[model samples]
Structures are given as structure tokens and as C-alpha cells.
Target chain A: MNDGTSATVTEIDMRNTSLRDLNRQLHEATSGHFVVTNPRGAHAVAAGIDSDIVVELRGSVGYYAAGMLQRGTVIVDGNAGTGVAENMMSGVARVTGSATMSAGATGCGGLLVIEGGAGARCGISMKGLDIVVGGDIGHMGAFMAQAGNLVVLGDADHHLGDSIYEADLFVRGDVASLGADCEEKEMSAEDVDLLTQLLERAQMTADPGDFRHFGSARQLYNFHPDDINSEVAEARS
Target chain B: MTGENWHQRESYTFDRNVIAEIHRAANTGIYRIRGFGAKRRLPTFDDLVFLGASMSRYPLEGYREDCGTDVIIGEGRAERPVHLDIPITIAGMSFGSLSAQAKEALGRGANAAGTSTTTGDGGMTPEERGHSKTLVYQYLPSRYGMNPDDIRKADAIEVVVGQGAKPGGGGMLLGQKITERVAEMRTLPEGIDQRSACRHPDWTGPDDLEIKILELREIVGWQVPVYVKIGAARPFYDTALAVKAGADAVVVDGMQGGTAATQDVFIEHVGIPTIAAVPEAVRAMKELGAHRDVKLIVAGGIRTGADVAKALALGADAVSLGTAALIAIGDNSPSLEDQYQALGTTAGCWEDYQDGTDPAGITTQDPELSARLDPVVAGRRLANYLQVLTLEVQTLARANGKSHVHNLEPDDLAALTVEAAAMAKVPLAGTSWIPGMG
Candidate 1:
């Protein structure tokens, strides 16, 4: 079971195994390292792993890879489809290649490191999951993000962090436009330190000072009668 | 004109309610938000009447004969299908929308009745899970308070696509109801207006939903059933899509379904009636050859056992109760008339659930108001109500010469109005003609 690493290894070939058996085994294992080969864009690869195990998918994964993962480590060596690591609670999920829409969506607690770019809504509705992207992210990134830290090493597309709450966004390059209620803020020493630590964890060499911070304006938290008409008009446009 | 014979004319379009709403909108510059279902009437189960057995078919003895009320949901697909003592079950209502005591009572009652209770938009709470024998966890668009550990604790999982009151809109919990505890669970600031997302954050469409269902199945180890719940917008298509998306059961909620907080306009104007939606959903399920295998639970405006029986006859496997269940738990009680009047409304007509000043304590976050409700007492009331409903259904089924409630079919029913006949696809009373059949 040993595969050069100190931990015991369990090898699973996706071509020969059913998705059910793979996840069931992962769920039951208390502690082990799982090496999955030939994932080949299969959805929900390594989803719902609750135990404190480590899973490494060798190839591309389809939608919801490592979804709702808890107390585990899932590393996808290739590109990920939509909603990778979605709603993950307390785990580490890494995508070596780019991820599609809603990566790390609604995650309560976790660390998701994407070595490449991400699609739209990269961290939509994210809660307390730290996502570090090595490359640029698409529009509407971090939309309505509740609580989390999202760090993008490259430029961001338009309308980032629409209707966000509490979540912090740090981007290094130019952003097309800010979303409703999302605004750029001056980077403080704390922001710098947080970004620096995230970068080091993701293994991306970027100066924390180069990144600008963004957060919620908190204007839309409650209903305001006076601003209703204008906000509605803005939404329509 | 005589002193007592004077008359005043009023336009139907500009009625008193309309005038008041217009004035309120003009003054506030905001739409009216409230709770409860549609106030306007539509063709409903009340328009349908069951035909008891006569000389040709012998009826079972009303009190002496046994008529089964038990139902099994998620039979074929799920490893453990839910077994209910009655065909009626409680629908999803959030902990944030209701008091914790109210949630606990619902669980306690459902447990006593041998049925299931569902968790709502706010996610599963310990009170609900601890009290109920069977609990269905709702996977909402918000994912607020959603975690893997809680998902594993559930007996069933319901993927909420939409609600009946506002089919295409998100959920609304006004600032007044968002207490410190609610805020912590939902990861939001206390006393802020909360708007839950309309569409799911991760997936969209049936194709994506299929994958989503698979993920959930994997999460629960395929031990619990997965139900896809849709507001009855386009029931036929939605039911078919849900079946194709790998649901063990389908829940169709019509326009008459209740809400904790929603715009008054949306509640009245959107979606079809419950009776209208059922037949179409049934047709789709039958067409897919997945009719009974994938159980159907219909909701909205289901008050009496007659409504439940009619729904079953129209091809529903079971019926869910929302507003009616709240009534059973003492919401809008006439005993609280004085307090209701203090809030500028009568007890029976009160709909300002968004205000968090509920006199009955069923729908408020204020500790004092919530404390007015005793969980044990409320639970007993709900259990008694459930027992009465079950007895009524049994009486009707025995009269129809059915051994079980599920045996009642469309042939045993007739509609009173032409609209009802057309919508329910049943023949009109005293006539063989069904308006839409020809």
C-alpha cells in the first residue's frame, strides 16, 4: 500500500471502478492516500469524502469534483469542470489546471488552490473557504461571497464580488468593472500578511503589495425605500 | 334618498383592497411583502366531489372495515423508502421563518403521526433532527448552514428548485426576523434583510441537476432517497425533467402554497393552482413509465382530508401540508385576536409574518413571543389534527369501496364546475361531458 510517501496508498482506476464504490471506500477509510487514475472528465470524482484521507485524481474531472468534501485532501492534476469542490466543509481541494464556473462555491471551510485560471462565478456564495488562483478569473467572480478569502494572482474580469458579504478579494491586475456593492479598498498590513500567506500556501510567487483588496459596501444589507427605484433600474440595465 | 336606503357604488378594479395597496405603495415606495398563500380564489379540490359506492358496488363498513392509509415514498430507487402511517406529510418550512419551538413541535408531531418532517432554507437544526424519527434535509440555493455532517444525518434529501408562492423568485426573510442565532447560522449580519438565491449556486437545468443528484447520492452513500421539489410553474415538463434527472420522488407545489415572506403580487399572480398542476404532472410521470416508481407529493391549499383524497385520486402518491399545518400548530389563532388587532390586523386575516411580531409565537424570533408557544402542547394539537385527517380520509376511502386510500381513482370523482372539470380532467356533475376532453 506504500507508494513512496509515508502514508498508505489505495490505487483506484476510474475505468474499472464505479463512482459509487470509489466514494464509498473513500468515506469509510479513516486515514489513507488514494491515487485515482484515468478520471477522464467524470463528474463528482471523489465527492462527499468525510474521512481524513488524501485523494489524488490523475486526470481531468467533470462537475463537482471533491464536492462537499470534509476532512480530506483532493488534488486534481488536470482541468476541472463546473463546481469543483462545491460546498466543501473543512478540506483541501486543489486543481492543477483551470476550473469552470462556481469553483469552491458555498464552501463553509476549506483551502482550494487553482494553479490556472477560473471561469465565471469562481467563488459564488462562498463561505469561509480560502481560494487562491494562480491566474486570471472570469467575470462575476466571488459573486455574493459571504465569508472567505479569494486571491487572484492575475487580472480579473468584470463585476467581481457582486452583492458580496464579509469575503475578502485580492486581485493583482486590472479589473474590468466592480459589481454592485463591491468596492476596492486600501490594502492594510493585515491584508498584505493574509495575501502573502495564501500565496505561499498556493506556491504562487507574487508580492502581496501588488494586489488590491475588494469587499462589500454593506449598502444593500437592508431594504431602503429611497434607493429602490434606482437600484431596480440599475439591475435591469 | 331615504336615510337607511342610501347606496354607494364601487369599481371592482379599484376596490378597497386595491385602493389601500395603492396608497401604501405610494407612501412607502415599496411593494407590499407578506406571508400566507394567494388570497384570490381559483378552481380547487372543493369543486370536486367523490361518488360513494351504491347498489352496483358494495361499500365497506365505515367504522368496522379496515382502510389502510400507509404510503411508501421513494420505493424502487432508495435503499430505505420512507414508510408513513398516513398519506399526508408536513412540508418544508425553515427554522428561521418559524420559532425553534415551532420547528420542534412540527418534528414531535410528525414523529407521533408516523410521517416525515422537512428541514428548510436555513438548514437542519438539532431540535428538528433530535425530535423527529424521519427528517428530510432541504438542499436550498443559499446553502446557508449547509454542511456535510448534517447531510449525512438526514433520512432524505430534497433539492429545492423553487417555492410555490413565488415560482421564479428567491426567499425573503425580513430584517425584523433575522435574530442573532439566525444570522450566525446563515453567515450574515443580524437584523439584515436576507434574500436567498433563486437558482442553485452550483448547477442549472436538468442536465446539470442529474449530476448534482449523483453527487448527493454519493454523499449519502445511496442510503436515503433524493426528492426534487419544484414550484408548479410547468409541472408536466418539470416532473419529467426531475425523473430524467434521477429523482426517487417529485414534489410539485402550486400557487396556493404558503411562504414565510414574499411579495403579495408574486403570491397571487404566479403559478397554477394545485388541482390544475397535479393531472399534468401525473400525465408526464405516466408518459415516462415512471409513474408509481417515482412517487409524487402534491402541495398547496390542501386543507381537509377531502383535498388529500382528491389529490390521491388525481394521481398523486401523497399530499404535503404547509399553511394548514401551521394552523394546526396554532398560527393565526382566534384566541390571539386582541394582540392581532394591536398589530393592525384581525387574527384570522393577519398576514404580516415578515414583521416578526406574530401573536401566536409560531412565526417570530422574539423570545417572549416564541415562549408563548409550548412545544409539547402544540405537538399534541398537530398530532390530533393529523389523526382527524387520517380518519376522514379512511371514511371517504371506505365509502368509495377502496381497501386502501391509494386505490381511489379518477373514476370515483366528479367536478362541480366546468372550470374544475376541465382542469381536473374529471366529468362535470350531472353530465358526462368534460369541457377539455372533447
Candidate 2:
């Protein structure tokens, strides 16, 4: 629901302008489909972006691109650096290329879709954000992830889902190792359906059956005196 | 043996507390984690005496005189620097260690007192943001709840390099205090011990820190002031470095500063006393030709208005409060003596914040315990305490024959102890003898 009609497009050349001035202009300009040309891997290119508008950045961007976006859609045509869509409240931050570390980190509500691979700690400590990575994710990808769905259609790296909380993981590839307190769980029909929906949202062709679910067993959620007893009992059995 | 009464008791070097600590360490096989500041005695503001106007100068009327107590920090650097009615500010205390209600109380109290409240390690909370007139968001090592939106919402950004209790060490939020909300905010599991990293992930040195500072300014449109906070171990060097890195204000927290949880060894072993730190920080700024240019805000163990006066006299622009603010909000009240005894501690000696069983509801995350502290009442109490502190400072300023509190210089002070005189770099009472004079 931008002030400018979907037919109209506003083009901005970012070569001469400073990042602060560019972001300020975006914040001040009420609403529009802003087309940014020649980003050239600039950091926080459209950071703290608010307003119900669409931003189409032409090329690769540096760290914190589209960070803290609220009620808008940011489509990065190329690769994104660290902390893409970080702490986003509500919106869509879609990167057509791969992303660096901590993508969608601490995001409460949003849809972050990466069409390619993601670097280390991809969804670390996510909160209620759905992150869809079309390719592999690096080591400790979902470490301490609290909530939300992390869907990876390709492979995942070492120590996946280490010390994760209530966040659900859907992976379709082999993992190297697992971290403490994380466990693989059986994927139900509901899990497949969710994966199917996410894949469709990311505009990718992938089989839902190829995905496996991972989550926390919640055993280490609380400290108890009877923990030793449970461990000993399992050992005996 | 023949004269039992004549025999000296246990050696002072190996006191009961020392012996107990040895035994406790032997049994636990781990360092003791606790809250509060150093329990041992050290030279402090108590060792400093004021030269009340007596002979040559005349004392202003306590009730009628116009003694200014207002201070302006970040005067020129920031597009909008906070103009405080009083020099005392509420220091950073995390939401995880403290209840949301407690954080809200700090905000309300600071707002009422016309001072800024800091958002501590865990990130900014909505309650704090909504209640506080001026909120300083901490960019800590952990980056737990860091977001550009919250950063933009903040009035200031304090890049936390170190804390007073554990200068080189990171912070800890024990599992018992990590409730659902805290866990979600930190992106850790509920009821799991969260250990913050000691160093920032992006930058390793001061040169890199300079870049990080610029990046932060870029994020906020260069409107809010950037503050750099460091423990008071190397105040002279650290203050100079922070200024070089483009900080509008520098916060130097002394060793007596309180913490939510840290090793007992670290609390007592690290950092310098507040009495010593203020002068060093001031000296650094003065040497670098940025004395008043970059505002110096000191913290740690500041309780009384006289302490505030002494700090200002020693060249601190402002003072921040942590433990004293919590006490004002009803932590460790003598009324909770029964509860303290039940928890195997005394009222004023309570320090087990890691256990999450705070009787005063100021530290715990329990719903019932947290609800016990009403934000409105606590805020009013804090405001009342701040008013007294401001009035006392004004009274001292009037007595010193100075129109403004900042006008009271080191000349107005005299030390009562050799250690205090040496540490504070001030002359002894009725004598020109300054112990550490160069």
C-alpha cells in the first residue's frame, strides 16, 4: 500500500549520496517503490527502513542491509552481507543471492528469504521470524535460536541447532555434526505442509518430502535435582 | 596456652571470611558467583572533608541562595545532548537480572528527576523506552537484543567496553533468572545460563572501534550522542583512547560499582576506587586538550549528594548510580529482614542475585515477586531520593561560596586520610601536604 501506485517506480542513484542521507531520504519520503542503483556492497544501505513501500536494490550490499525493516518489502537482487533483515519487526526482506552470517538474527516478525547459501550462525537467536534459505547454511547455523521456522532446502554445516529453544528447523541435506542439547525429531504431515508453504513463498521448486525437522528436546530447559536420576535410568535401560 | 586471654585470636590475614571462602572454593570446585560490589573497606569519599565557608568566605542561606546544580553533558558534539537538572543519572542494569517492572521504575524515576536511564546488556525494552524521557541504549559485547530500530529509538548509544565489577570479563545472566521473555530477547533458551562475550565481534582495537563508532553514527543519522563506557582500571589511558575514538561522553565506572552477577574474586580484585578514578579521568581529558570538550561521566559506588559534589569537584561532569538506585527502588530493605534471614543472608548484605530469589522483587523474574514492586511508587521513592541528593549538592555548593555546583573545584576539598589524599590528589586537612604530588 505505497503512496505511489504499483505502476510507478522511483529511481535513485546511490553513487554520490552518503548512506545517512540516503536512509534519511527514504525515511522522509512518505511512500514509493524505490529502485536503488549501484549499491556496490554498501553497509546498511536501507537500514531502519519503515513505511509500506517496496525497495529494489540493484546489486550486492554489505552488512545490515535492510535491517530493522518495518512494513515494507526489500528485494536485494544480489548477495547480502552479515545481519540481513536483522531485528526486523514485520516485512519481507528477500535476497535473491547468498547471505553472510547472522541473517534474520533476533527478528521478531518477518519473512526473510535467501535464494542462495547462508554463512555461519544463519538464524542465531531468531524470534518468530521465518527464514528460508534455498541453499546450504554454515556451522552452528541455528545456535540458540528461540522461535520461528528456519527452512533450508539444501545442506547444513557442522553443529546445527546447538542449544536451540522452541524454534523449528527444516533441513533437506546432510549435517556434519550436532551441538549439545539439539536433537533430530520426526517430521509429521504438518511439518511437511509448513515446508511446502515456505518453499512456495520463497518461489523455489523443492520437494517437501526431502526435508527433515529438528528442534529442542527441552530436557535442559530447567535444572533439577532428579536430572542425574533420569540419566542413570536411561543408562541402565 | 597458660594465658588464653592473652593469646591473639585468628590472624588478621586469615580472617573468618577468608577461611570460609577457601573452604567454599575447595568444596564447590568453581569460583563463587555473586552480586553487589566489593565488601571490603577501601578509601572512599568518606575520607574526604569539605571546607565549609567559615572565615574569609561567607556561606549562602541554605533555603534562599541560588546554588546551581544543573549540568549539561555532550554539550557540543551531539545534535541533541541531554540537559540534566541534576548530575546523578541511573546507570545500566539489564532487564534479565532485574524485573521489567524494576526497569520501568528506573525509567520513570529518571524521567521525573530529569536524568537519563540506560538500557543495559540485554537490549532496550518497550517499557523502558515508553517511560523514560531520555534512554541510553547500551551496545554491549553480546549484542543480545541489538536492533537498528531500538538504536534509533534511543536518545544515546553507550558502547560498553568494560564494566567496573569485572573489567576484562564478560557478563552473566544465570539460568534461574532467564525467563521466557528474557530468553526470547536474548535469543537463548529459557532457563539457560547466558554468558556474554567479553569482546565486541566486529572490532578488536581502538582503530577498529573508531570505525564502529562512525557506523553507529551513520545508523542514527548523527543525532544522538555516542558514549564510551569503560571500567576505572586504566582511566588515564582508557579515557584518552575513548576520546580519540570520537566519543561525545566517557563513563568511567570505579571498582565499587555493583553488578547483577560476577565472580567474588573479580568484584574485589579488579578496577580502581571511585575516589582515585575521577582525577585520573579528568587528568587524561585535560592532557589531551579535551577536558570540557568531551564530557566525563563517572560512576560506581556513588550514594550521597556529598559524593556527587566530591566527584564533580574532582572534575567529573556527572555521576551514574546502579546499586544506590536499586536500593532507592526498595532492594535489600530492612523490612525484608525476615526474608533475607530465610535466604541465609542479611538485609544490607544480600548479594545472591544469580539465584533469582530476590525478596524485594527488584532483581527476580518471578511474576509474583516482580509484581510486588509497583513502578509508580518506586519511581516516586527514587524521585524523592534524587531531590534530596540535588538539594544536598546545592547546599554544599552554596557553602563553598560557588554559584554553580560545577564551580566547586578541588580547592574546596581536603582529605582526612593519607590514602584518600594520595588517591584523590588533594591536600590533607589544615596542611599543604599532598601525598602523591608530582
Candidate that scores best on DockQ: 1
lDDT of 2 at B203: 49
**Model 1: per-residue Cα lDDT over B177-263, one tens digit each:** 899999999988899999999989989899999999999988888888999999999999999999999998899999999999999
**Model 2 chain B weakest lDDT span, ten residues long:** B199-208
DockQ for model 1? 0.53
TM of each candidate vs. truth: 0.96, 0.83
- Model 2 clash pairs are none
Query: Among all windows of ten consecutive residues in candidate 1 chain B, which has the lowest summed lDDT?
Result: B1-10
lDDT of 1 by residue, A1-237 (tens): 333345778899989998988888888787889999999999988998877788999999999999998888999999999999999888799999999999999988879999999999999999899999989999999998999999998889999999999999999999999999999988999999998888887788988988999999999899977555566688999
DockQ of every candidate: 0.53, 0.22
* Chain A TM-score vs. truth, each candidate: 0.92, 0.91
TM-score of candidate 1 against the unseen true structure: 0.96
